[model samples]
Target: IEKEGWSGEVSGRRKDGSPITILITASLVKDEKGEPICMMDSFVDITERKFMEDELRIKDNAIASSLNGIVIGDLEGNITYVNDAFMELWGGDDISEIVGKSAVTFAEDEDKGRSIINVLQNEGNWTGEITGIRRDGIPITVQLSAGMVYNEKKEPICMMCSLVDITKRKEAEEKLQRSHEELEIRVQDRTKELTKANIKLKKEIEDRKIAENTLLKKEKELELKSLNLEEANTALKVLLRQGEKDKTELENKVLQNIKELVLPCIEKLKIYRLDDKQQAYLDILESNLNNIISPFLQKLSSKYMDFTPTEIQVANFVREGKPTKEIAELLNISERGIEFHRNNIRMKLGLKNRKTNLRTYLLSLA
Candidate 1:
């Protein structure tokens, strides 16, 4: 039994020899002499409450020992408790000094306001990113989760918070972003450089094509001049064969002068620096001069080989530097027929693979 207005819990031996715990509360009204009293009593078994309290203590210990930072704050935004991990994160020197301090005090300057605390007080919870400063003044980035706790009267008793450090992860992400930006810049610069180089290369190719065209035109002009000289030689030859003795010496002197002086001068001009086309024309003139006329002009060698009358005429006409048209008229054939005999002469003389002008090749055999 409990005395008036006295409350206590008692553990006693039960009939089964087991221990039992009880919580008893009572109120009483006493007489004037205070010797007798009217009393009311209420009682409850408190074993369950003890078990619940022990379980809560275990949970608290578990949270304290966790690797993450855990904090408890009062509704006034004062830090009421912090676990070991939280202290370690803050330089691990003094945790007692942190007690009763405002939770927002350790936040970075950018987050110095009690926005989270106010939210928790008004809405029973808040969570977000927070930049915090450690005890040694080191900066850290963390993910924070906080919620309010309430008492039976529905008054906010405390706020519980957990912090996960994400500084390393954030740094890695920043580095990757910077690297991506740098690579893009390099790609753009390289592309610009390549574009410029391509433009220059295109210009160079155009210049080369222009130069090649100029050389080709020069070569065609030189080939025409060579054909004219070959025609004059043929005409001179026919005139020499038909002339009387007195006219022969004058005609021979004229031919000799053309060959020794005028032709040599022209040959010197042919040797001048020329483009591809000009060089091709010069090659034609040079081959005909050396291979055609030089062979037949050798008096002693003329008797060693047989000559068809057309070949003889063609040879003698070319030796005197006659044009192909004059040679065609002398032979009483069309110019095309003259060209056909010239081709036959070229094949008989095995003058294949010579890029020299055809007239020049025929004259070379004279």
Candidate 2:
């Protein structure tokens, strides 16, 4: 059975009995005849071609579904195809408006775009950041990586480009640059303040050094004056000791003169019989003579003491070996009052040490 100018695929077998797939083109072959005499068919094997077509469709679908914009351009840098992402990124709703344009037309910097194409043609690849303009005329920064697409023979056919929008990264970098400039300005201002503070600190240090030097000089002068004062005090102490010795000697001589020259005359007058009034006058003269030497005896009695009148009276009674009872009668007070005064005298004269007796301590002071 044969048909004229009608062909279709069908299951068949080769001479070797291996199954095969075929694409047949049907035609009529006759000698200059308009009517078909016999059917001539051309059989072509399409098994590998079908597999290649299916693979190409799968890859194309993947490219179309990608998030980053991707484009394919011919050898002349004219756009050949664009993914859905590319159209969306470029603000294009229709692919017809973008497919035939030069790939550089979307770049804000066309000069850099042309240079990138030139590099891709020579080196088979190019990748860099470039400014791209959307169809809406809004500009965006993008990272572009592109390489030549090859056919089955490894011949260069076109270039496929991948683009990622880096607009936020670029904007953040510019903001960081501005902040760095401000920080530099603040550092300069702080450095100036520190410089001024350093200058003031140097002045204060210089003033303190001068003050310390002056204080040291004054201290040396004070030490020299102290040495001179110490020597003067030593000489004054020696002179005071000599003067005390002379004073004691003068008192002894006066006492001796009075005892030797005047006392015998009073004794002789006492022996002579005299009226009561005259005897009273003679007694007063002898008593006044004894009063003249009393101060020197008082010095010996007190042992160079300067006690109050009551304390001196108490000390004299104790030294005279007067008991507490007799001393209290003489002082017109109780025995306890005499004991109290005796305790005070013992304390003021630094007595009562090692259980010393009040009478013995006062006698020793005398």
Give the winner by lDDT. Answer: 2
Writing each residue's lDDT as its tens digit, candidate 2 over 276-319 gives: 86886787568656754666335634363556566666666677
Root-mean-square deviation (CA) per prediction: 18.2, 21.5
Model 1, 132: alpha-carbon shift in Å? 1.7
Q: Which stretches of candidate 1 lie over 4 Å from their true place?
A: 1-44, 152-154, 201-366
Q: Give the Å shift of residue 118 in candidate 1.
A: 2.3
Query: How many clashing residue pairs, candidate 2?
Result: 0
Model 1 scores worst on lDDT over the 10 consecutive residues at 295-304
Question: Whole-model Cα lDDT per candidate?
Answer: 0.76, 0.82
Clashing pairs in 2: none
